[model samples]
Target: RHPGWPARLGPLLVPVGRVALRPPRLLDGGAWSHVRTRDRAHLERWEPTSTVDWADRNTVLAWPGQWGALRGMARRGQALPFVITVDDELAGQVTIGNIVRGALRSAWIGYWVAGDRVRGGVASVAVALATDHAFNVAGLHRLEATVRPENAPSLRVLQKLGFREEGLFRRYLDVDGAWRDHLCFAITTEDAPEGLVARLIGSGRAQRP
Candidate 1:
Protein backbone atom coordinates (compact mmCIF):
# COMPACT_ATOMS: atom_id res chain seq x y z
CA ARG A 1 0.00 0.00 0.00
CA HIS A 2 1.49 3.35 -1.00
CA PRO A 3 0.92 6.59 0.86
CA GLY A 4 -0.44 9.98 -0.28
CA TRP A 5 -2.59 8.35 -2.96
CA PRO A 6 -5.93 10.16 -2.75
CA ALA A 7 -4.73 13.49 -4.10
CA ARG A 8 -3.96 11.77 -7.37
CA LEU A 9 -7.20 9.71 -7.66
CA GLY A 10 -10.74 10.96 -8.34
CA PRO A 11 -14.33 9.76 -8.95
CA LEU A 12 -16.39 8.45 -11.93
CA LEU A 13 -20.04 8.01 -12.59
CA VAL A 14 -20.79 5.07 -14.91
CA PRO A 15 -20.80 6.53 -18.42
CA VAL A 16 -24.25 6.90 -20.00
CA GLY A 17 -24.22 4.05 -22.55
CA ARG A 18 -22.20 1.27 -20.91
CA VAL A 19 -24.78 0.62 -18.21
CA ALA A 20 -22.90 -2.32 -16.73
CA LEU A 21 -20.36 -0.09 -14.98
CA ARG A 22 -22.80 1.49 -12.54
CA PRO A 23 -21.81 2.37 -8.99
CA PRO A 24 -22.59 -0.40 -6.49
CA ARG A 25 -24.78 0.33 -3.50
CA LEU A 26 -24.90 -0.96 0.07
CA LEU A 27 -28.44 -2.32 -0.21
CA ASP A 28 -27.48 -4.55 -3.09
CA GLY A 29 -27.09 -7.49 -0.71
CA GLY A 30 -28.72 -10.23 -2.74
CA ALA A 31 -26.82 -9.27 -5.87
CA TRP A 32 -23.53 -8.86 -4.00
CA SER A 33 -23.83 -12.35 -2.58
CA HIS A 34 -24.46 -13.64 -6.07
CA VAL A 35 -21.31 -12.07 -7.47
CA ARG A 36 -19.13 -13.09 -4.51
CA THR A 37 -19.79 -16.74 -5.13
CA ARG A 38 -19.79 -16.26 -8.89
CA ASP A 39 -16.43 -14.56 -8.88
CA ARG A 40 -14.93 -16.32 -5.85
CA ALA A 41 -12.45 -18.49 -7.77
CA HIS A 42 -11.44 -15.56 -9.96
CA LEU A 43 -10.83 -13.13 -7.10
CA GLU A 44 -9.13 -15.39 -4.53
CA ARG A 45 -5.96 -15.42 -6.58
CA TRP A 46 -5.73 -11.65 -6.87
CA GLU A 47 -6.89 -10.48 -3.44
CA PRO A 48 -7.60 -12.47 -0.33
CA THR A 49 -10.55 -11.71 1.83
CA SER A 50 -9.68 -9.42 4.67
CA THR A 51 -11.78 -8.42 7.65
CA VAL A 52 -12.97 -5.65 5.38
CA ASP A 53 -13.83 -7.73 2.33
CA TRP A 54 -17.44 -6.64 2.55
CA ALA A 55 -16.65 -3.11 3.63
CA ASP A 56 -18.34 -1.55 0.68
CA ARG A 57 -21.74 -2.80 1.78
CA ASN A 58 -21.40 -3.26 5.50
CA THR A 59 -19.24 -0.48 6.82
CA VAL A 60 -20.55 -0.96 10.35
CA LEU A 61 -19.29 -4.53 10.49
CA ALA A 62 -15.76 -3.43 9.81
CA TRP A 63 -13.51 -3.65 12.85
CA PRO A 64 -14.12 -0.29 14.46
CA GLY A 65 -10.43 0.19 15.13
CA GLN A 66 -9.37 -0.81 11.62
CA TRP A 67 -12.11 1.34 10.13
CA GLY A 68 -10.93 4.34 12.09
CA ALA A 69 -7.35 3.68 11.09
CA LEU A 70 -8.24 3.50 7.42
CA ARG A 71 -10.60 6.46 7.64
CA GLY A 72 -7.81 8.52 9.14
CA MET A 73 -5.48 7.39 6.40
CA ALA A 74 -8.14 8.29 3.80
CA ARG A 75 -8.71 11.67 5.37
CA ARG A 76 -5.01 12.30 5.12
CA GLY A 77 -4.94 11.24 1.45
CA GLN A 78 -3.73 7.64 1.42
CA ALA A 79 -6.09 5.55 -0.77
CA LEU A 80 -9.49 5.15 -2.43
CA PRO A 81 -11.76 2.17 -3.15
CA PHE A 82 -14.74 1.41 -5.46
CA VAL A 83 -17.10 -1.43 -6.22
CA ILE A 84 -17.95 -2.38 -9.84
CA THR A 85 -21.34 -3.59 -11.00
CA VAL A 86 -22.91 -4.66 -14.31
CA ASP A 87 -26.42 -3.68 -15.39
CA ASP A 88 -27.61 -3.46 -11.79
CA GLU A 89 -26.10 -6.87 -11.18
CA LEU A 90 -22.94 -7.43 -9.15
CA ALA A 91 -20.54 -8.82 -11.74
CA GLY A 92 -17.21 -7.63 -10.43
CA GLN A 93 -15.17 -5.11 -8.48
CA VAL A 94 -12.59 -2.58 -9.65
CA THR A 95 -10.38 -0.37 -7.60
CA ILE A 96 -7.85 2.30 -8.42
CA GLY A 97 -6.45 1.42 -5.04
CA ASN A 98 -2.96 2.05 -3.73
CA ILE A 99 -2.62 5.54 -5.15
CA VAL A 100 0.65 7.48 -5.12
CA ARG A 101 0.60 11.11 -6.08
CA GLY A 102 3.12 13.83 -6.92
CA ALA A 103 5.73 12.53 -9.36
CA LEU A 104 3.89 9.26 -9.47
CA ARG A 105 0.41 10.21 -10.60
CA SER A 106 -0.45 6.54 -10.58
CA ALA A 107 -2.64 3.89 -9.00
CA TRP A 108 -2.81 0.13 -9.30
CA ILE A 109 -5.86 -1.01 -11.26
CA GLY A 110 -7.29 -4.39 -10.25
CA TYR A 111 -10.48 -6.05 -11.45
CA TRP A 112 -12.23 -9.37 -12.12
CA VAL A 113 -14.95 -10.29 -14.58
CA ALA A 114 -17.35 -12.97 -13.24
CA GLY A 115 -16.67 -16.49 -14.48
CA ASP A 116 -20.11 -16.68 -16.06
CA ARG A 117 -19.34 -13.45 -17.88
CA VAL A 118 -15.88 -14.27 -19.18
CA ARG A 119 -15.24 -14.37 -22.99
CA GLY A 120 -18.08 -11.94 -23.46
CA GLY A 121 -15.55 -9.11 -23.35
CA VAL A 122 -17.46 -7.39 -20.55
CA ALA A 123 -14.21 -6.52 -18.89
CA SER A 124 -12.57 -5.16 -22.01
CA VAL A 125 -15.19 -2.46 -22.38
CA ALA A 126 -15.64 -1.95 -18.64
CA VAL A 127 -11.92 -1.42 -18.12
CA ALA A 128 -11.69 1.25 -20.79
CA LEU A 129 -14.47 3.00 -18.93
CA ALA A 130 -12.70 2.52 -15.61
CA THR A 131 -9.46 3.95 -16.94
CA ASP A 132 -11.27 6.86 -18.55
CA HIS A 133 -13.15 7.43 -15.32
CA ALA A 134 -9.91 7.44 -13.42
CA PHE A 135 -8.40 9.97 -15.79
CA ASN A 136 -11.40 12.01 -16.84
CA VAL A 137 -13.50 11.74 -13.72
CA ALA A 138 -10.93 11.02 -11.04
CA GLY A 139 -8.45 13.39 -12.64
CA LEU A 140 -5.65 10.84 -12.42
CA HIS A 141 -3.22 10.68 -15.34
CA ARG A 142 -1.93 7.08 -15.35
CA LEU A 143 -3.25 3.58 -14.70
CA GLU A 144 -1.48 0.23 -14.49
CA ALA A 145 -2.45 -3.42 -14.10
CA THR A 146 -0.55 -6.59 -13.24
CA VAL A 147 -1.62 -10.12 -14.05
CA ARG A 148 -0.20 -13.58 -13.58
CA PRO A 149 1.71 -14.51 -16.72
CA GLU A 150 -0.59 -17.50 -17.08
CA ASN A 151 -3.68 -15.34 -16.96
CA ALA A 152 -4.29 -15.02 -20.66
CA PRO A 153 -7.86 -13.84 -20.27
CA SER A 154 -6.89 -10.88 -18.15
CA LEU A 155 -3.90 -10.15 -20.36
CA ARG A 156 -6.22 -10.11 -23.34
CA VAL A 157 -8.43 -7.60 -21.58
CA LEU A 158 -5.45 -5.31 -21.17
CA GLN A 159 -4.42 -5.74 -24.77
CA LYS A 160 -7.96 -5.05 -25.96
CA LEU A 161 -7.89 -1.85 -23.99
CA GLY A 162 -4.57 -0.90 -25.59
CA PHE A 163 -2.42 -1.30 -22.47
CA ARG A 164 1.23 -1.74 -23.32
CA GLU A 165 3.15 -4.63 -21.83
CA GLU A 166 5.70 -3.01 -19.55
CA GLY A 167 7.63 -5.92 -18.02
CA LEU A 168 7.38 -8.77 -15.59
CA PHE A 169 7.61 -8.64 -11.82
CA ARG A 170 8.32 -11.95 -10.21
CA ARG A 171 6.54 -13.24 -7.14
CA TYR A 172 4.38 -10.14 -7.13
CA LEU A 173 0.92 -10.94 -5.74
CA ASP A 174 0.09 -13.89 -3.53
CA VAL A 175 -2.40 -16.16 -5.29
CA ASP A 176 -4.34 -19.10 -3.89
CA GLY A 177 -1.71 -19.65 -1.17
CA ALA A 178 1.44 -18.89 -3.15
CA TRP A 179 3.16 -15.81 -4.46
CA ARG A 180 3.04 -15.53 -8.25
CA ASP A 181 4.94 -13.68 -10.94
CA HIS A 182 3.01 -11.06 -12.89
CA LEU A 183 3.22 -9.30 -16.24
CA CYS A 184 2.60 -5.61 -15.96
CA PHE A 185 0.57 -3.52 -18.39
CA ALA A 186 -0.53 0.09 -18.56
CA ILE A 187 -2.56 2.70 -20.53
CA THR A 188 -2.06 6.41 -20.17
CA THR A 189 -4.48 9.20 -21.00
CA GLU A 190 -2.34 10.10 -24.00
CA ASP A 191 -2.29 6.56 -25.40
CA ALA A 192 -6.07 6.03 -25.38
CA PRO A 193 -8.11 6.58 -28.53
CA GLU A 194 -10.91 9.07 -28.47
CA GLY A 195 -14.37 7.44 -28.26
CA LEU A 196 -12.83 4.16 -27.14
CA VAL A 197 -16.08 3.05 -25.50
CA ALA A 198 -17.98 3.04 -28.77
CA ARG A 199 -15.24 1.13 -30.50
CA LEU A 200 -15.09 -1.57 -27.83
CA ILE A 201 -18.84 -2.04 -27.70
CA GLY A 202 -19.28 -1.58 -31.39
CA SER A 203 -17.00 -4.54 -32.01
CA GLY A 204 -20.15 -6.42 -30.93
CA ARG A 205 -18.84 -7.43 -27.51
CA ALA A 206 -20.69 -5.26 -25.02
CA GLN A 207 -24.46 -5.72 -24.98
CA ARG A 208 -26.01 -2.36 -24.46
CA PRO A 209 -28.59 -1.95 -21.74
Candidate 2:
Protein backbone atom coordinates (compact mmCIF):
# COMPACT_ATOMS: atom_id res chain seq x y z
CA ARG A 1 0.00 0.00 0.00
CA HIS A 2 1.07 3.60 -0.47
CA PRO A 3 2.48 5.06 2.72
CA GLY A 4 1.91 8.72 3.39
CA TRP A 5 0.56 11.29 5.89
CA PRO A 6 -3.07 10.40 5.31
CA ALA A 7 -4.28 7.02 6.45
CA ARG A 8 -6.00 6.07 3.19
CA LEU A 9 -7.84 7.07 0.08
CA GLY A 10 -11.23 5.64 -0.90
CA PRO A 11 -10.48 5.27 -4.60
CA LEU A 12 -7.77 5.99 -7.21
CA LEU A 13 -5.80 2.79 -7.73
CA VAL A 14 -5.92 -0.70 -9.14
CA PRO A 15 -3.68 -3.68 -8.56
CA VAL A 16 -1.14 -3.75 -11.36
CA GLY A 17 0.84 -6.55 -9.91
CA ARG A 18 4.26 -7.80 -11.09
CA VAL A 19 5.81 -4.37 -11.36
CA ALA A 20 4.51 -3.49 -7.94
CA LEU A 21 5.30 -0.24 -6.11
CA ARG A 22 7.21 -0.07 -2.87
CA PRO A 23 8.61 2.50 -0.46
CA PRO A 24 12.17 3.60 -1.13
CA ARG A 25 14.72 2.08 1.18
CA LEU A 26 18.21 2.79 2.50
CA LEU A 27 19.68 0.09 0.32
CA ASP A 28 18.67 2.22 -2.64
CA GLY A 29 21.73 4.41 -2.18
CA GLY A 30 24.03 1.90 -3.79
CA ALA A 31 21.59 1.44 -6.66
CA TRP A 32 21.20 5.17 -6.94
CA SER A 33 24.97 5.64 -7.11
CA HIS A 34 25.22 3.18 -9.97
CA VAL A 35 22.38 4.87 -11.85
CA ARG A 36 23.83 8.28 -11.18
CA THR A 37 27.12 7.24 -12.69
CA ARG A 38 25.51 5.64 -15.72
CA ASP A 39 23.00 8.38 -16.48
CA ARG A 40 25.36 11.32 -15.99
CA ALA A 41 26.10 11.73 -19.66
CA HIS A 42 22.66 10.89 -21.05
CA LEU A 43 20.98 13.25 -18.62
CA GLU A 44 23.46 16.09 -18.99
CA ARG A 45 21.18 18.05 -21.29
CA TRP A 46 17.84 17.71 -19.49
CA GLU A 47 18.48 17.41 -15.79
CA PRO A 48 19.51 20.39 -13.74
CA THR A 49 22.02 18.61 -11.50
CA SER A 50 24.77 16.68 -13.23
CA THR A 51 27.60 14.25 -12.51
CA VAL A 52 29.25 17.14 -10.74
CA ASP A 53 26.10 17.53 -8.70
CA TRP A 54 26.44 14.04 -7.29
CA ALA A 55 30.20 13.60 -7.68
CA ASP A 56 30.76 16.02 -4.91
CA ARG A 57 31.46 14.04 -1.74
CA ASN A 58 29.12 16.23 0.28
CA THR A 59 26.01 16.11 -1.89
CA VAL A 60 26.06 12.36 -2.36
CA LEU A 61 26.14 11.96 1.38
CA ALA A 62 23.19 14.29 1.92
CA TRP A 63 20.92 12.85 -0.76
CA PRO A 64 19.80 9.85 1.22
CA GLY A 65 18.37 11.88 4.07
CA GLN A 66 16.57 14.27 1.79
CA TRP A 67 15.39 11.48 -0.47
CA GLY A 68 14.10 9.50 2.46
CA ALA A 69 11.89 12.34 3.62
CA LEU A 70 10.59 12.95 0.14
CA ARG A 71 10.04 9.25 -0.43
CA GLY A 72 7.94 9.03 2.69
CA MET A 73 5.66 11.81 1.55
CA ALA A 74 5.24 10.07 -1.79
CA ARG A 75 4.33 6.64 -0.47
CA ARG A 76 1.45 8.07 1.52
CA GLY A 77 0.26 9.79 -1.63
CA GLN A 78 0.64 13.10 0.12
CA ALA A 79 3.17 13.63 -2.62
CA LEU A 80 3.84 11.32 -5.59
CA PRO A 81 7.42 10.08 -5.63
CA PHE A 82 8.08 6.55 -6.81
CA VAL A 83 11.22 4.60 -7.54
CA ILE A 84 10.81 2.15 -10.38
CA THR A 85 11.95 -1.40 -9.80
CA VAL A 86 12.50 -4.20 -12.28
CA ASP A 87 13.38 -7.52 -10.67
CA ASP A 88 13.67 -5.58 -7.43
CA GLU A 89 16.36 -3.28 -8.77
CA LEU A 90 16.16 0.49 -8.76
CA ALA A 91 15.69 1.67 -12.33
CA GLY A 92 14.60 5.29 -11.89
CA GLN A 93 12.30 7.73 -10.17
CA VAL A 94 8.97 9.41 -11.01
CA THR A 95 7.60 12.21 -8.96
CA ILE A 96 4.43 14.30 -9.05
CA GLY A 97 5.50 17.60 -7.73
CA ASN A 98 3.44 20.67 -6.85
CA ILE A 99 0.12 18.91 -6.17
CA VAL A 100 -2.96 21.09 -6.07
CA ARG A 101 -6.32 19.73 -4.97
CA GLY A 102 -9.93 20.90 -4.57
CA ALA A 103 -12.15 21.40 -7.64
CA LEU A 104 -9.08 21.03 -9.81
CA ARG A 105 -6.89 18.20 -8.61
CA SER A 106 -3.72 18.22 -10.59
CA ALA A 107 0.02 17.66 -10.37
CA TRP A 108 3.05 17.83 -12.60
CA ILE A 109 4.78 14.54 -13.42
CA GLY A 110 8.58 14.47 -13.62
CA TYR A 111 10.69 11.42 -14.28
CA TRP A 112 14.07 10.16 -15.42
CA VAL A 113 15.22 6.62 -15.96
CA ALA A 114 18.67 5.42 -15.02
CA GLY A 115 20.92 5.49 -18.05
CA ASP A 116 21.35 1.75 -17.81
CA ARG A 117 17.62 1.16 -18.28
CA VAL A 118 16.79 3.72 -20.94
CA ARG A 119 15.55 1.53 -23.79
CA GLY A 120 14.05 -1.33 -21.82
CA GLY A 121 10.51 0.21 -21.89
CA VAL A 122 10.51 0.85 -18.16
CA ALA A 123 9.83 4.55 -18.55
CA SER A 124 6.62 3.95 -20.43
CA VAL A 125 5.49 1.27 -18.02
CA ALA A 126 6.23 3.35 -14.98
CA VAL A 127 4.59 6.45 -16.35
CA ALA A 128 1.44 4.53 -17.22
CA LEU A 129 1.33 2.97 -13.78
CA ALA A 130 1.77 6.33 -12.13
CA THR A 131 -0.83 7.90 -14.35
CA ASP A 132 -3.31 5.19 -13.42
CA HIS A 133 -2.65 5.84 -9.77
CA ALA A 134 -3.02 9.57 -10.21
CA PHE A 135 -6.42 9.10 -11.77
CA ASN A 136 -7.85 6.23 -9.77
CA VAL A 137 -6.07 6.36 -6.43
CA ALA A 138 -5.18 10.00 -6.07
CA GLY A 139 -8.51 11.02 -7.58
CA LEU A 140 -6.81 13.43 -9.89
CA HIS A 141 -8.30 14.49 -13.19
CA ARG A 142 -5.12 15.61 -14.86
CA LEU A 143 -1.57 14.33 -15.13
CA GLU A 144 1.04 16.42 -16.88
CA ALA A 145 4.64 15.88 -17.85
CA THR A 146 7.23 18.02 -19.62
CA VAL A 147 10.32 17.17 -21.59
CA ARG A 148 13.09 19.09 -23.25
CA PRO A 149 12.46 19.71 -26.94
CA GLU A 150 15.55 17.75 -27.86
CA ASN A 151 14.89 14.76 -25.64
CA ALA A 152 13.24 12.43 -28.10
CA PRO A 153 13.36 9.44 -25.80
CA SER A 154 11.36 11.11 -23.06
CA LEU A 155 8.97 12.62 -25.54
CA ARG A 156 8.38 9.15 -26.93
CA VAL A 157 7.70 7.76 -23.49
CA LEU A 158 5.12 10.43 -22.69
CA GLN A 159 3.45 10.01 -26.02
CA LYS A 160 3.49 6.25 -25.65
CA LEU A 161 1.79 6.57 -22.30
CA GLY A 162 -1.27 8.39 -23.67
CA PHE A 163 -0.12 11.87 -22.68
CA ARG A 164 -0.96 14.40 -25.39
CA GLU A 165 1.16 17.31 -26.50
CA GLU A 166 -0.84 20.15 -25.08
CA GLY A 167 1.65 22.86 -26.01
CA LEU A 168 5.23 24.01 -25.84
CA PHE A 169 6.53 25.74 -22.74
CA ARG A 170 9.54 27.85 -23.66
CA ARG A 171 12.27 28.21 -21.07
CA TYR A 172 10.44 25.97 -18.67
CA LEU A 173 13.32 24.53 -16.72
CA ASP A 174 16.90 25.28 -15.79
CA VAL A 175 18.83 22.25 -16.87
CA ASP A 176 22.55 21.54 -16.56
CA GLY A 177 23.28 25.26 -16.88
CA ALA A 178 20.75 27.21 -18.94
CA TRP A 179 16.98 27.53 -19.07
CA ARG A 180 15.51 25.12 -21.59
CA ASP A 181 12.35 25.01 -23.64
CA HIS A 182 10.00 22.04 -23.19
CA LEU A 183 7.09 20.37 -24.93
CA CYS A 184 4.13 20.10 -22.62
CA PHE A 185 2.24 16.81 -22.41
CA ALA A 186 -0.90 15.84 -20.56
CA ILE A 187 -3.29 12.89 -19.99
CA THR A 188 -6.66 13.11 -18.37
CA THR A 189 -8.72 10.12 -17.23
CA GLU A 190 -10.97 10.66 -20.20
CA ASP A 191 -8.08 10.31 -22.61
CA ALA A 192 -7.27 6.77 -21.51
CA PRO A 193 -10.38 5.05 -22.80
CA GLU A 194 -8.38 2.25 -24.34
CA GLY A 195 -5.81 2.32 -21.56
CA LEU A 196 -3.05 4.91 -21.38
CA VAL A 197 -0.48 3.49 -23.76
CA ALA A 198 -3.03 1.90 -26.02
CA ARG A 199 -5.02 5.09 -26.50
CA LEU A 200 -1.88 7.14 -27.05
CA ILE A 201 -0.58 4.79 -29.73
CA GLY A 202 -4.05 4.33 -31.22
CA SER A 203 -4.38 8.08 -31.65
CA GLY A 204 -1.32 7.88 -33.99
CA ARG A 205 0.84 10.14 -31.84
CA ALA A 206 2.81 7.59 -29.79
CA GLN A 207 4.71 4.39 -30.41
CA ARG A 208 3.46 1.08 -29.12
CA PRO A 209 5.23 -0.07 -25.99
Candidate 3:
Protein backbone atom coordinates (compact mmCIF):
# COMPACT_ATOMS: atom_id res chain seq x y z
CA ARG A 1 0.00 0.00 0.00
CA HIS A 2 1.11 3.52 -0.70
CA PRO A 3 1.56 6.02 2.09
CA GLY A 4 -0.27 9.34 2.22
CA TRP A 5 -3.29 7.96 0.35
CA PRO A 6 -6.58 9.80 0.43
CA ALA A 7 -8.90 8.96 3.30
CA ARG A 8 -12.06 8.71 1.12
CA LEU A 9 -13.06 7.79 -2.42
CA GLY A 10 -16.56 8.57 -3.57
CA PRO A 11 -19.97 8.67 -4.30
CA LEU A 12 -18.92 7.78 -7.86
CA LEU A 13 -21.19 7.01 -10.80
CA VAL A 14 -20.77 6.72 -14.54
CA PRO A 15 -23.65 6.34 -16.97
CA VAL A 16 -23.67 4.54 -20.27
CA GLY A 17 -27.04 4.31 -21.91
CA ARG A 18 -29.22 1.86 -19.98
CA VAL A 19 -26.19 0.77 -17.98
CA ALA A 20 -24.50 2.65 -15.14
CA LEU A 21 -21.47 1.94 -12.99
CA ARG A 22 -21.34 2.72 -9.28
CA PRO A 23 -20.06 1.42 -5.99
CA PRO A 24 -21.93 -1.35 -4.22
CA ARG A 25 -24.52 -0.42 -1.60
CA LEU A 26 -25.42 -2.15 1.66
CA LEU A 27 -28.95 -2.87 0.43
CA ASP A 28 -27.58 -4.58 -2.68
CA GLY A 29 -26.37 -7.69 -0.88
CA GLY A 30 -29.46 -9.75 -1.70
CA ALA A 31 -29.48 -8.78 -5.35
CA TRP A 32 -25.77 -9.43 -5.69
CA SER A 33 -26.13 -12.85 -4.13
CA HIS A 34 -29.03 -13.74 -6.38
CA VAL A 35 -27.08 -12.88 -9.50
CA ARG A 36 -23.98 -14.74 -8.38
CA THR A 37 -25.96 -17.78 -7.35
CA ARG A 38 -27.54 -17.98 -10.75
CA ASP A 39 -24.17 -17.61 -12.42
CA ARG A 40 -22.10 -19.71 -10.01
CA ALA A 41 -21.82 -22.77 -12.21
CA HIS A 42 -21.12 -20.59 -15.22
CA LEU A 43 -18.43 -18.59 -13.43
CA GLU A 44 -16.79 -21.42 -11.53
CA ARG A 45 -14.61 -22.60 -14.36
CA TRP A 46 -13.04 -19.16 -14.69
CA GLU A 47 -12.95 -18.00 -11.08
CA PRO A 48 -10.95 -19.04 -8.08
CA THR A 49 -12.42 -21.06 -5.25
CA SER A 50 -14.36 -18.77 -2.95
CA THR A 51 -13.13 -18.25 0.58
CA VAL A 52 -16.78 -17.75 1.48
CA ASP A 53 -19.56 -20.18 0.69
CA TRP A 54 -21.39 -18.14 -1.90
CA ALA A 55 -24.45 -20.37 -1.85
CA ASP A 56 -25.05 -19.84 1.84
CA ARG A 57 -27.82 -17.28 2.30
CA ASN A 58 -26.38 -16.20 5.60
CA THR A 59 -23.02 -15.41 4.02
CA VAL A 60 -24.74 -13.16 1.51
CA LEU A 61 -26.68 -11.43 4.22
CA ALA A 62 -23.34 -10.43 5.68
CA TRP A 63 -22.15 -8.66 2.53
CA PRO A 64 -22.54 -5.15 3.89
CA GLY A 65 -19.22 -5.56 5.73
CA GLN A 66 -17.53 -6.70 2.55
CA TRP A 67 -19.03 -3.81 0.64
CA GLY A 68 -17.78 -1.44 3.30
CA ALA A 69 -14.30 -2.90 3.10
CA LEU A 70 -14.35 -2.49 -0.66
CA ARG A 71 -15.25 1.17 -0.22
CA GLY A 72 -12.51 1.55 2.33
CA MET A 73 -9.94 0.32 -0.17
CA ALA A 74 -11.29 2.73 -2.73
CA ARG A 75 -11.06 5.54 -0.23
CA ARG A 76 -7.36 4.87 0.14
CA GLY A 77 -6.90 5.03 -3.63
CA GLN A 78 -6.04 1.38 -3.55
CA ALA A 79 -9.01 0.19 -5.63
CA LEU A 80 -12.09 1.19 -7.57
CA PRO A 81 -14.84 -1.24 -6.69
CA PHE A 82 -17.88 -0.92 -8.90
CA VAL A 83 -21.19 -2.57 -9.59
CA ILE A 84 -22.68 -2.38 -13.05
CA THR A 85 -26.40 -1.84 -13.44
CA VAL A 86 -28.90 -1.90 -16.26
CA ASP A 87 -31.96 0.24 -15.63
CA ASP A 88 -31.18 0.18 -11.89
CA GLU A 89 -30.87 -3.61 -11.68
CA LEU A 90 -27.56 -5.10 -10.54
CA ALA A 91 -26.12 -6.61 -13.71
CA GLY A 92 -22.48 -7.11 -12.78
CA GLN A 93 -19.34 -5.91 -11.00
CA VAL A 94 -16.09 -4.41 -12.26
CA THR A 95 -13.19 -3.78 -9.94
CA ILE A 96 -9.85 -2.13 -10.52
CA GLY A 97 -7.76 -3.60 -7.78
CA ASN A 98 -4.09 -4.18 -6.84
CA ILE A 99 -3.40 -0.51 -7.23
CA VAL A 100 0.23 0.54 -7.13
CA ARG A 101 1.26 4.14 -6.99
CA GLY A 102 4.72 5.83 -7.06
CA ALA A 103 6.68 4.49 -10.02
CA LEU A 104 4.08 1.93 -11.09
CA ARG A 105 0.78 3.82 -11.15
CA SER A 106 -1.06 0.70 -12.30
CA ALA A 107 -3.76 -1.73 -11.28
CA TRP A 108 -5.54 -4.91 -12.32
CA ILE A 109 -9.09 -5.01 -13.65
CA GLY A 110 -11.55 -7.82 -13.00
CA TYR A 111 -15.23 -8.25 -13.74
CA TRP A 112 -18.21 -10.57 -14.01
CA VAL A 113 -21.69 -10.23 -15.47
CA ALA A 114 -25.03 -11.87 -14.81
CA GLY A 115 -25.59 -15.14 -16.67
CA ASP A 116 -28.28 -13.68 -18.95
CA ARG A 117 -26.07 -10.72 -19.87
CA VAL A 118 -23.12 -12.67 -21.25
CA ARG A 119 -22.26 -11.77 -24.84
CA GLY A 120 -24.81 -8.97 -24.73
CA GLY A 121 -22.04 -6.32 -25.01
CA VAL A 122 -22.26 -5.66 -21.27
CA ALA A 123 -18.72 -6.80 -20.54
CA SER A 124 -17.25 -4.72 -23.31
CA VAL A 125 -19.04 -1.57 -22.22
CA ALA A 126 -18.24 -2.15 -18.58
CA VAL A 127 -14.58 -2.73 -19.33
CA ALA A 128 -14.37 0.38 -21.47
CA LEU A 129 -15.96 2.48 -18.76
CA ALA A 130 -13.67 1.10 -16.06
CA THR A 131 -10.65 1.66 -18.26
CA ASP A 132 -11.66 5.28 -18.75
CA HIS A 133 -12.16 5.71 -15.03
CA ALA A 134 -8.79 4.19 -14.24
CA PHE A 135 -6.90 6.63 -16.42
CA ASN A 136 -9.07 9.71 -16.11
CA VAL A 137 -10.40 9.58 -12.58
CA ALA A 138 -7.85 7.44 -10.77
CA GLY A 139 -4.98 8.98 -12.71
CA LEU A 140 -3.38 5.66 -13.31
CA HIS A 141 -0.96 4.95 -16.10
CA ARG A 142 -1.75 1.30 -16.83
CA LEU A 143 -4.46 -1.27 -16.28
CA GLU A 144 -4.06 -5.02 -16.70
CA ALA A 145 -6.30 -8.07 -16.87
CA THR A 146 -5.69 -11.77 -17.13
CA VAL A 147 -7.85 -14.53 -18.58
CA ARG A 148 -7.68 -18.25 -18.22
CA PRO A 149 -6.33 -19.66 -21.46
CA GLU A 150 -9.56 -21.49 -22.15
CA ASN A 151 -11.86 -18.60 -21.35
CA ALA A 152 -12.89 -17.42 -24.81
CA PRO A 153 -15.57 -14.98 -23.70
CA SER A 154 -13.19 -13.15 -21.39
CA LEU A 155 -10.53 -13.07 -24.07
CA ARG A 156 -13.05 -11.48 -26.42
CA VAL A 157 -13.90 -8.85 -23.87
CA LEU A 158 -10.27 -7.81 -23.49
CA GLN A 159 -9.82 -7.81 -27.24
CA LYS A 160 -12.80 -5.55 -27.75
CA LEU A 161 -11.38 -3.17 -25.23
CA GLY A 162 -8.12 -3.02 -27.21
CA PHE A 163 -6.01 -4.48 -24.43
CA ARG A 164 -2.79 -5.71 -25.96
CA GLU A 165 -1.79 -9.28 -25.28
CA GLU A 166 1.34 -9.09 -23.19
CA GLY A 167 2.22 -12.76 -22.88
CA LEU A 168 1.32 -15.96 -21.04
CA PHE A 169 1.86 -16.95 -17.46
CA ARG A 170 2.24 -20.52 -16.41
CA ARG A 171 0.05 -21.63 -13.55
CA TYR A 172 -0.71 -18.01 -13.01
CA LEU A 173 -3.58 -18.33 -10.56
CA ASP A 174 -5.78 -20.72 -8.65
CA VAL A 175 -9.06 -21.08 -10.51
CA ASP A 176 -11.94 -23.30 -9.49
CA GLY A 177 -9.57 -25.04 -7.11
CA ALA A 178 -6.88 -25.72 -9.70
CA TRP A 179 -3.79 -23.87 -10.78
CA ARG A 180 -4.44 -22.42 -14.21
CA ASP A 181 -2.42 -20.74 -16.91
CA HIS A 182 -3.49 -17.27 -18.01
CA LEU A 183 -3.06 -14.87 -20.88
CA CYS A 184 -2.00 -11.41 -19.83
CA PHE A 185 -3.46 -8.31 -21.42
CA ALA A 186 -3.03 -4.62 -20.71
CA ILE A 187 -3.78 -1.05 -21.77
CA THR A 188 -1.94 2.12 -20.81
CA THR A 189 -3.21 5.66 -20.58
CA GLU A 190 -0.82 6.65 -23.32
CA ASP A 191 -2.39 4.04 -25.55
CA ALA A 192 -5.77 5.79 -25.44
CA PRO A 193 -5.35 9.43 -24.48
CA GLU A 194 -8.82 10.36 -25.72
CA GLY A 195 -10.53 8.00 -23.25
CA LEU A 196 -10.98 4.22 -23.73
CA VAL A 197 -14.79 4.23 -23.65
CA ALA A 198 -14.94 6.71 -26.47
CA ARG A 199 -12.26 4.84 -28.37
CA LEU A 200 -14.18 1.58 -28.17
CA ILE A 201 -17.40 3.19 -29.35
CA GLY A 202 -15.69 5.12 -32.10
CA SER A 203 -13.77 2.13 -33.40
CA GLY A 204 -16.89 -0.02 -33.21
CA ARG A 205 -15.07 -2.56 -31.06
CA ALA A 206 -18.05 -1.98 -28.81
CA GLN A 207 -21.24 -0.10 -29.53
CA ARG A 208 -22.47 2.67 -27.28
CA PRO A 209 -24.68 0.84 -24.78
Per-residue lDDT of model 2, residues 1-209, tens digit only: 34232222111122221233444566677777767766667765676744555455224465588577876666545577777775566767777766777887888988777675567666666677667667776778897788888888888887666578989888888886887888889888888755664543455533422
Off by over 4 Å in 3: 1-17, 57-59, 204-209
- Top model number, TM-score: 3
Of 1 and 2, the candidate ahead on lDDT is 2
Model 3 C-alpha lDDT per residue in residues 1-209, reported as the tens digit of each score = 33323222222223333566787888899888888888877776777766766576325667788798898997877888888886678888888898988899999999998887666677777788777767876778899899987889899888877899999999989888888899999999888878767776676645443
Tens digits of lDDT, candidate 1, 89-207:
55665656666778777887887766766666556666766676667655667888988888888888888777899999998876656778889898777886574565565666554
- Per-candidate clashes come to 2, 7, 0
User: For candidate 2, what is the lDDT?
Assistant: 0.66
Candidate 2 segments exceeding 4 Å error: 1-20, 49-52, 57-60, 75-78, 197-209
The C-alpha TM-scores of every prediction are 0.71, 0.78, 0.87
Most lDDT-accurate candidate: 3
Residue 31 CA error for candidate 1 (Å)? 2.4
